[model samples]
Target: MLKWLRRSEPKEVPAATLGPLQIVKPWARSSASEPDVGGGYMTVVNDGESDRLVSASCSAAGSVEIHAIRVKGPALEMRKQDAGLVIPPANQQILKPRGYHLLMRDLASPLLAGSKVPVTLVFEKAGSVTVDFAVEEPGAVGHVTLRSS
Candidate 1:
């Protein structure tokens, strides 16, 4: 019967867009030895109206936390990100050393320089995005080796 056939047919759904956040020049840095921890840096350009980086996760590390650094007297201090990393309208959020960065804690294995790592960032508006980060030498010039291709 036509009615039975129609009922059994699948319905078509519209495809969804990826998101508005664009990750640029992602990179990672780790210690010389079997590093159990490391730092992640990148620039998040928000094409959407606005969004917030709620959290991040790294497959290579047991825990990944969003962090920021503050200039404390003659020294700089690093700590967890309060609230969240906010992405303003058509603005960019930067993550770099001595600034806003990701702390990879309790890594399962060592992450040597020149290695690539996968990280997922969860946003309030645009949703989640997984990107690759190219590792660089510890004293590399401004993490210039980072590339997002």
Candidate 2:
């Protein structure tokens, strides 16, 4: 005997559609003097659902952590985001200067301008995404020396 057709059927999500996260305008500030620390900026957009950015890693640098700036009295201060960065559904997380950004400490070498810095971002839902950050001038702002065009 053959089975009858069902009234409704469940659908399975595709693997390609699982990765609905995107990274835009990834950039890192260049250090001319081979400083002990470096910084990077980017925008993480989640078009599907909520996710948590657990951690980050870079082979070129010693350590990687999420950082944010806070104004304390008459001065501004920078600190690590111990809880990690979270990405809400249909929302975007920004990583910029004087805000929620990334900290690259104990650099192996100076981040030269017009170069690329490869970093891997680990997400709880989306897994890991490896993106390259364009190196900009030491004191420059915006996406001036973007090489990942």
Model 2 stretches astray by more than 4 angstroms: 1-18, 31-34, 140-149
- 26-142 per-residue lDDT for model 2 (tens digits): 889744434556788888777888998888999888999887776556555666777788888998788887678887888887788899989988888899978888888776232
Error of 2 at 21 (Å): 0.6
Candidate 1's TM-score: 0.75
lDDT of 1 at 59: 85
1-149 in candidate 1: lDDT tens per residue? 35553456653221222377678788888744436778888888766788888899998999888887776565656668757789887878889887888878888876767788998878888888787888887542222122222
Q: Rate the local accuracy (lDDT) of all candidates.
A: 0.74, 0.75
User: In terms of lDDT, which candidate is strongest?
Assistant: 2
Positional deviation of 106 in candidate 1, in angstroms?
Answer: 0.9
Score residue 142 of candidate 2 by CA lDDT: 29
Model 2 gets an lDDT of 0.75
All candidates: CA RMSD (Å):
13.1, 11.4
